[model samples]
Target: MEYYEGSFDSIVGDLVAGNRVPAVISDEEYGWIISISYPYKSESGELLGYVCADISMDSVVRDRQNYLLSTLLILAGVTAVFAVLYYVLFNYVFVRPIKRMSGAAAEFVSGGRDGEFSSSIATLSVRSRDELRLLCDSLKRMELNIREYVNNLREVTAEKERIGAELDVARHIQSSMLPCIFPAFPERREFDIYATMTPAKEVGGDFYDFFMVDERHLAIVMADVSGKGVPAALFMVIGKTLIKDHTTPGRDLGEVFGEVNRLLCESNSEGLFITAFEGVLDLGTGEFRFVNAGHEMPFIGRKNTFRAEKIRPGFVLAGMEEMRYRAGVLQLNEGDKLFEYTDGVTEATDAGNGLYGMERLERVLCAHGADTPQEICEAVKRDIDAFVKDAPQFDDITMLCLEFRQKTPGIKEEEQ
Candidate 1:
């Protein structure tokens, strides 16, 4: 074979420029070749010849492609194995436990009042020694606490409902004890009487009564007991019964109160007392005899003008034993009215802590001049409500109004 010469200009130029670069070229003889060159220099670093080498790139390219293919295949196999292992480990360590906890929580919430939630949460198990286990344990304790709290809440709610029901019944019973019917003395036309009581609570201590002791004498009572609610209401019942029982047409007013006071003092175990006012109006003579026991002053309306009656109040009933009370007498003419009330009217509070005082009461009474007893009471209540807008009533309010129209002539007294 004839020898052939090949040009290596690119490789020689790179060697001269102090670059150690290899060159690839296509050749008729070698098909594909890579030429590399290194300079053989003198000790003084002068220009010198180059030592060159040519490598067949076809085999090298094929070998490199084979090596890359093998590497990629090995990498793909390793990655597939790693992915499978990861899926198994992750499912067992994290996903499975998490799913179990989620299922148990769902069941607990949906279990309802049959109490299966406790068992569902308590039986949950997490095998991992990580935050999952800690969370499972915490969930169990929380479930127990929540269940106990719910049970206690149910008991308390039931107890409150029972108490509310009892109080409702007590309110109705107490209301029935008073004279709720209107036209109290419909048979007699000598006087027109109207009275009302508004309790601060379900039951109150304030009470009023009007009944005929005889055909000639009409007895009226207005009283307030100490305290409020059940205890005071019970005391009110006793006091009202005692007052009515002792009042008679022939008995002296002072003597009647004296006996009632002694009886109340004997059974006053609760330290409760009453401020009471009782009056007997003789319809024939227009004579009014009344006793004041630590009670508010009565208003006398004469000639269309009202004035507070000045009477010295005696000690409250049940305050002490052997307390002597005095009686006051008033001559009632035709068209005269007597208005009586408890301290609740004068002491009614407003949102601003101001009192609906005696001044306001007297003003309200005077404003409703010559009005009927019913109209007068309604006027006063309306005025009080206006003055005490949105404020809670702090005491029991009671009122009684009796208008003496005329003396009944030729009316025979009924035998007692």
Candidate 2:
């Protein structure tokens, strides 16, 4: 208190300017202080020494800081509570329902238990009236449609299987109708004959037959119908029966075909026709008489080679009424063979759509000309297969071979 000496420039300046100013001051003991300074003047307001008052500010500042901290903590607590509430509400409304739907879809697609398909999505109950509920309903409807489709598919599959079984039986029956037994005339040693028929489909339109008309006459038939499959097979049966029944011992082949053509025209309601050739060989003299109706020419094997024998073809059987036919004769010497076939051998195709034409057929036939009748037929088939190479068969292939060795001993020689 005695001789207080400290720098008071700001206080002095305020006092000289005759102002009362409050200011912040620092002290070692009080830490922080506020002061107000003023001039102590005479009663008439003359210049005089100054007087000042100081106050500590620590308690006021501390109280204000505590209030702000309390306010911030309360706000943080309120924000956290709102956030928790929002999460629960959102999960119940959207996330939980979505998770349930996903699980149901997975179960259904994974092939649940026998009765679980209908119940998998149908039992998902979404309480909210939103797009998710609509989606659930859609899933249920889809499941129902799938079930109906499966039932219909099963029925269709069963029907298809039944049809396939019937077709298989039909194939076997058609095969049995042909002369499948080799060495057909086993007891006779005067000649050897062999033939084969392979259908492009389950059944074929081509057929061949050989039967002894009498002790001296051997009749052979080779024919191809206009179409294929069941209808063609039925027509083939009719034509075969008609021709065989009309052919009798010593009956001229031309007259037999003429009569058979009339009979076929009367019954040809399906507008079908046949390309046929029939030949009668006399075992005593080797006189071969044949008639052709819109069919391929026969290949004659002689001198260890094969050549196509040219013949004028008449109209196809069942083409029209009163179509005349004529018989062509050939003298078959000893060791000569007759090879007959359908157009299938020539028209066979490859993946490149190339035809296995007559040139190729003749080459193959001549290559195996010296072999037995059965071996010759098999060789031709193998060559055709090699040329076609995995291509689908589109037509029926049929072939017949007849080798007239010599007349039977003790048989009367017929004059040719």
Candidate 3:
């Protein structure tokens, strides 16, 4: 091997010493370099040796470039696929719900009724168990709840209207039961009487009536039932009728009250009772006999002064089966006035939770004693309203007033 190497070097040096051009030639088998001399020379201007370097990069450079190109193409394709999938998912799950929700919100804002919100975006099954799905579910449920609430509100409002209508009818019927026409008998100049009732609610249990017992006496009655509404109204009717039936020109006031009390107790079912004041006025003598049944004291106005008359009150009717009553008498001179009322007046409460007590009522009566019966009643109502000052009325207020007049025999003859 050493001799061969030396021989090859000597030959290459002789060729390159001749100033030859070196050429590298390669083939599939192996690679080598050849040197060719331009002019033949031996000692002068000759190359020492041919210089050559040969290397093969067939596996390293070519294979690496091809591998890199293939990797880049695979990565681009994968990225494209991922981007397409993301686009599809975003449109189906996110974009679709957002669009539907926006449209629904717009419709709701444009005067849509409660039923319009029933439609939901939960039908899209793309991302069924994710946050977006839960959001959609919640929205659907909220819409359902809102719809149900609105329906309930409407039903409540309708029920309230129905109750209000029934109450109105009840009020009309109750008012008809009383004497609404004023000046009941305008031509009977022997006396002037008037009464009024203002109920806190649509219907009340306060009532008043006046009727002539033959030609010599006048009957007046005022009552307040224990309860309110239809039951109390019915009781008031029974009480008034019973009292009127027993009242006659010569009938004793105490006997009339006792009989009425016994009759009420016999038929009373809910333990209802009444506080009543009944009176009979002799048209000729101006003498009044009255009975109080657990009622308020009466006020008499004479010579421009009003004072509460102390009268003994018997037991409330319809509560006891064997109750007794007594009568009290008062002689009313001509031009004398009498006032009677229910406890609703004195018990009226103000905004400050203060009662319009007996003292205030007396003051009101004295202040408006000279006015007509209607005017006096109005004055009392105004004072109550002023005192209450936006507070709710809790009971029925009623009032009755009477003026006595002696019939002149000569004038009656003249009229006849």
Best by lDDT: 1
- In order, the Cα lDDT scores of the candidates are 0.88, 0.86, 0.78
- Report the candidate with higher TM-score, 2 versus 3: 2
Stretches of candidate 3 exceeding 4 Å from the true structure: 1-127, 130-156, 407-416
Q: Which stretches of candidate 1 lie over 4 Å from their true place?
A: 1-123, 126-163, 411-416
Sort the predicted structures by TM-score, highest score first. 2, 1, 3
Q: Which ten residues in a row have the lowest lDDT in candidate 2?
A: 1-10
TM-scores for the candidates: 0.73, 0.74, 0.70
lDDT of 2 by residue, 267-342 (tens): 9999999999999998888899999999999999997689999899999999999999999999888889999999
lDDT of 1 by residue, 293-393 (tens): 99999999998788999989999999999999999999999999999999999999999999999888988888886999999999999998999999999
Better of 1 and 2 by TM-score: 2
Q: List residue ranges in candidate 2 displaced over 4 A.
A: 1-141, 413-416
* Cα RMSDs, all models: 6.8, 7.1, 11.9
